[model samples]
Target: MTTAVFAGVDVEVNEEGFLVNSDEWTADVAEAIAADSGVGPLTELHWKVITFCREDAAREGTAPGLRRISKLSGVGMKDLYALFPKGPGKLAAMVSGLPKPQSCI
Candidate 1:
């Protein structure tokens, strides 16, 4: 684990940089993480996906898969790819401050 400062808060992250505690996540933290990940300054559309991922993770006790994120978040697959290039599922989880999805490689 590594301690990182985001939004002036110190939080732990794994080797892959995923948050160790989802409870410590905030919009400011997300902004910092996003910028670090080269994903943002997050847009309103990004916020929609991030908010959906956080809420869904809280309800399910795990991060949602890309298919779930696309279907439920009202963000289509193409748009998800456009919004979070490289790997949408993994990147979305990272930016949303949730643990990496089990389905992610």
Candidate 2:
């Protein structure tokens, strides 16, 4: 793990950049992370996914996969791809300050 500063907020993160402590997450941190991950200037749709991921991870103790995220958020897989690019499940988890989903590569 390593320490990172996002929008001036210091927090610990894993090698892949997922937050070590979910409690350390904030909107500023999310924005910074999104920017760093090439998904910046989060739109309302992005917030919807991010919020759902964070809440679902808090309840499930693990990040949700793309299927769950797509079904639950009512955002189709294609949209998720457009919103996150390359890897939606992993990228969403990272931006949400959650660990990478087990279903992700």
Query: Which ten-residue region of model 1 has the weakest summed lDDT?
Result: 96-105
Per-candidate TM equals 0.95, 0.94
Clash totals for all candidate models: 0, 0
Pairs that collide in candidate 1 are: none
lDDT of 1 by residue, 1-105 (tens): 999999899999999999999988989999999988888689999999999999999899999999999889999999999998868878899999999899652
Runs in model 2 with CA error above 4 Å? none
